[model samples]
Target chain A: MIEEREIHKEYEIKENPLVDVAAYLFLEDIADKQGAAGMNNYLISLATSLAKSMPEEEYKTWEDFVESLEKGESIISTFESVRAKTNHCMVTHKCPFERGWKEYTKRIGDFARVHKEVADYYNSTVKPGVNDTQCIICQTFRAAAAERITVAKKRLKYAQLAAVAPDGSKKIAPDEWKPILLEKAGVTNTDLNMVLRNNACIWILY
Target chain B: MLDVALVSLIQDMSEKAGVEGTIQYWERVGESLAMRMGKEAYMGWPSFNVALREGRTAYSIEGDVTPLTDLAVTDVDGDVVGYIYALKTCVFEPTMQRVRYSVGDVPQADAAVAEEYNNSVKDTAICNFCVIHQKFREEVAKNITVADQPLECVQLADRGFKGETKIARDSLKRIGINPEYVRSLLRNYACVFAILMKGARLKGEEEVEE
Candidate 1:
C-alpha cells in the first residue's frame, strides 16, 4: 500500500475541473457517434470522481459539476477516423506484420473512443439525472465480446490452413507451411493454444 | 496439362450418361481398374491421399482417373525426356473435380495413353483442391522420389501433431524465423501459463469447489 502511494505521488494527478469536464465531453461525443449507449454509468462514476476531487470552492453538487463540464472549451485534436487510420497504416507500412499491429491498435483506440462518447451522451442527454449504474458494465461486456470475435476469426483461418497443406503434400514443403501460419496470423505458440483451447471445433465450422 | 475445355466435355458427357451411367462408369472404370490392378498392384486403386505440406488444397491423388489426352514427358524447358502412357478406362468427374484413374497398369500399354490419364487425374485433383495443381505436382515430383508408393495412413497419423504445430510454425517462418526457439518457449512455459490463466478464470468455480 505504501508502494502504491509512492507510485501515485510520483505522477501527480491533474486537478483541473475543466480538464475532467473536457474528458467527459469527449467521451460523450464518442458514445454518440459509436452507437455505444452502455457507458453512461461509467461516465456518471467518472463525473462523480471528478466532482469529489474538485475543491469545495469549485462545486458542491453533482449538477454543478456537469454544468461546469458543459462550459469547458471544446478542443478538437487531429483525430483520424478508424477506417482512415487503418487504411493509412496498412498502405504505408513496409512490413505487413507491423502494419497489422498498427491497424489493430487504431481500431481498438477508435472503439474505445466510441464507447466513451456513447457513455457521455447517455449520462448528459438520455435519462439525464437518473442514477442507474449498469450502463458501464454493459459497455465493458460489448467491448470484450467484440475483441473475442475478432480474435476467433483470425485464429480460425490458421486452423483452416492446418487442415489443408498449402502446396499439397506432393507440392509444398509441409515444414514450410507451419511457419507461414504463424507469420500470417500474428500468433505465437502461446496465443495459438489460447485460440485453440477457446475455439477448437467451434472455431472451424461455426 | 489437361485442358479445362476437355474436362467440361467429359462432365457434359457423363451427366448425359445419367446416374446409372455414372455408377457403371465408376464400376466399370473405377472399380474394374481397382479390381484388375488389384489396388496393391496399382491397376485399380480407387483413391489414395496425396500429401501436401503447405498452401491451399494440400492433399490430392494419383491414378484417380483416366487421361483424356496423351502425355509427352518433358523437362522444365519443354524438351522431351520420356513419354508416359495415357488410358481412357479412367473417367473424369468434373462435378467431383476428380480424375478416376489407375495408379498402376500393364507396362506394355501405350505410354501416350497413360500420360493422358496421369494428366487427367492430376487436373481433377487440382480442380478439386482449387489450387494450381501443376505447381503441387512439380513440387511433389521433385520432392517425392517415389510416386509408385502411396503415403500410408500410419505415416500420416504419426505426423498428426503437425496439424496444429505446423500452422504455428508456418506463421513464424514467413518472417524468416527458425521457430525452434518458440517451440522451446512453448515447452518451457505454455502449460504454466495455461494453468495460471485458467486458475484466474476459474477462481470462483474453484472457491465453490473448496
Candidate 2:
C-alpha cells in the first residue's frame, strides 16, 4: 500500500478530489464520442483502475461503477485474442488433473461442488456492463444458433418439392448436386449441406 | 540486357494483340513476373517501384487496407518488385477520409496505465483497441476536426505502441535493413502502426468502450 502511494506520489498524484472529478469527466467526454463507441468494453476496462478515484452518485449505479473498477481479471489483450479460444480456467481448478472421486457417494458430491463453483464464478465475475454483451462464448453460440434456426425455417419451403426419405425423415439437404460439384472442384474441407444452409442465400463457386 | 529482351517481347506481343491496351496490360504482367524473379535477374531493367513515395493518402497509396486489396510496387519495367499493403489493423477504423499509416510506436501498445491524468479528453486519441473499418477510411479529410484544427489525418499508431512491418526489408533489400531485425510475416499478420483514413462529420457522441 505504501509502495503504491509512493508510486502515485512520484507521478504527483495525491488523493485530490478535483483531480478525481476532472479525470472521470474526461472519461465521460471520450465515452460520449460516437467514433470511439466501437471499442470493446473489456478493452476500456484495462484502464478502469484510473476511475477508482471516481466518487459514487455520479453514475446510474454506484455498485456497477465500483464493480467495473476491479481490474486484472481479464489479462488477455485484444491482440493476444487473434483466434477464437475459450478460457475455462475457473472450473478447471476445482477439477484436479488425473484426480476424481473413486468412492460412489464422494463422486456425487464432487460433481455438485464443481457445478456450484462454475455457477458462483460466473455470478461473481460477469460484469454488469457492455462487457457482457461482447462475451465471446455468447456471441459465438448466438451466431451459430441464429444460423441453424434460419436454415431450419428456410428448409420448410423445399419440403413440398422433395419426397420424404425411406425412413420417413425429411431430407434437409439435396445430396445429388453438391457432391458432383465438390468432386469436380476437388474441394472437401466444407460440407455442402452445412455451407449452403448456413453460409449464404445465393450459391456460386469461382 | 534484360530490358532489351523485355521491350522486344512487349513489342512482339503488341503487334499481334491490339497495341493500345495489351501493351500496358502485358507490361504489368511482365513486371510482376520480373519482380517474382527477384531484383538480381532484372539487373538491366528499369525500376518503377514507389515503395517509399511521398504525398499520397492511404486511399491512393494502396486503395484499401482490407485484405485481398493488392498494392503493387514495381520497377521502371513495370515489374512488381514489392507489395505495399494496408495491414489488417485498419479493420477497426472507419474508412471515411483520406489517410495514411506509419510505423514505429512499440512502447505505446505496451503502456497499460498512463500516469498523470491531464483531465483533458482530447488526449485519449490513443486508439489502442479502436477499430476503423472501410467506411471510416473513406471519410473526407476536411471533415475531421479537433480543437478547431483540421484533423485531416488521425493516426491510431501515433499515440500508442507502434506497428512494425518487414515488407520493405524483404522486398527493397537495398534499403540495407538487417533481415534478422525485420519481422517475418506469417499469414499476412504484420504489425501495422496505423491506417490513415478519410475523416467524416461527427455528431459528437462516442465512447472508447462500446
Candidate 3:
C-alpha cells in the first residue's frame, strides 16, 4: 500500500512565486473588462507599440536590428537564425509567454484547472461560438506574439533600405521595399501569413 | 544534448531537405531513440511516481526544480498530482551548452548567428522524450499493479503535440500549451495525471492479490 506519509511528504514542496498574483489579477481584470476579442486586439496593439519603441539608430542593418532584439535577458530563451536557400532567413525561438505560463503553472499548480477556469469565465461572460474551442487567453497572447513579428518585419525592411543607401539622396519607395523584402527574404506572402496566423517559431527576415 | 556528429548530421539534413524536412528527420530520430530505450526506462509507472514525489518535495521546500528532470504535475482539483521525471541534465546539457555558444555574436556561414540558439531544438528533444513515454502507454495499456489493482498511465498533455509544427497547432487547439510549455517543466518530462488519482478500484480495474 502507498503510505499516506509518503504521499504527504511528496506533496510538501513548493516554489517561490515567480509572478505576483496581483499582476495576474490586474491582467485578468483588464481581460474581463475588455472581453476576449477586445483584449486580444489590445494585446496585439501593445506588442506593436513595444516593438516600435526600439531605437532605430542603434542598428546599421536588418541583421543588426534582429541581433539587438535578442540582446537582453527575457523569459524566452533559445533563439536561432537559420538562413535557407536563396535569401530566406528564418529566425526561430521558443515563445516567452508560453515559458512564463509554464513557470506560473509550476508555482500555482494544475494547468488544466487554470485553463478551464479561464475558459469557463470567457465562455460564460463572452459567449463563445459553438465551434470555438480556442482559449481566449491563449488567443490573446498568441496575437500579441504574432504582432511583434509583424512590426519587427516592418522595422527590418526600413533598416534594409538604410543599409543599402545611407545617404538621403537615393530614394526607395516603402511600397517597393515590400516586394523586394519578400524576394530578398525568400519568403512568399503565404509564408508570412502562415507565420503570423499560426504564431510559428520561424520569422522570415532577410 | 545531441553529439557533434548528430548536430552535423542535422545541419547536413537542413541543407539537403530544407527546414521542414530537417524537423521531420529529427522527429524520426527521437522516435527511434524512444523505441530503443524500451518502456520501463522511458515510461515506468514507478519512475513517474518517484519523480512526482521528488518534485513535490523539491517545490515545497522552495528547492531548485531543474528543468527536464524535476517536473511538477497537477490535477483537475488545482492540486499538485506529482512530478514525472524525464531526462537527466547529462542527457541534454551539451545541447544547452550549444545554445549558449550559438548565442554569442559571431557571423557563421550564410546566416548571421543570433544571440541565442533556437529553442525549437530543445523543445523537440523534450517532445521526443514524451514520444517515448507515450509509446509505452500505447503499447502496453496497463503495465503496473498498485495496491492489487492494475493501473494505466494517461498523459494529461496530448501526444499529438510532438513536433514543432504540431505543437504550434496544438497551442491553438488546446489553448496555451506548446513545446516551450512542455520543456519548461523539465528536459525529459511526461505530464501524466491519471495514475495519480485516488482509489484505483473505483476507476473499474480488477483487484488482484499483490
Q: What is the TM-score of each candidate against the true structure?
A: 0.15, 0.18, 0.28
DockQ of every candidate structure? 0.00, 0.01, 0.02
Tens digits of lDDT, candidate 3, A85-185: 23334433223234334444454443323323444454455433111212232233223333334333353221221111111112121465557666766
Docking level of model 1 = incorrect
- Which should have the higher lDDT, number 1 or number 2? 1
What value of lDDT does candidate 1 attain over all alpha carbons?
0.25
Q: How much is the lDDT of residue B143 in candidate 3?
A: 33
What does DockQ come to for candidate 3? Answer: 0.02
Question: Which of the CAPRI classes, incorrect, acceptable, medium or high, describes model 3?
Answer: incorrect
Per-model chain B TM-scores are 0.20, 0.18, 0.37
If both were scored by TM-score, which would come out higher, candidate 2 or candidate 3? Answer: 3
For candidate 3, write residues B1-210 as lDDT tens digits: 012112223333345665545444334433332232233322444554554446542121112323233333343344443333232222223232332332222112112111011243323123222332333333332433333344444443322222222222322222223446554533343232233333323211221222
Q: Which stretches of candidate 1 lie over 4 Å from their true place?
A: A1-117, A124-135, A138-206, B1-167, B171-181, B189-210
Q: What does candidate 1 score on TM?
A: 0.15
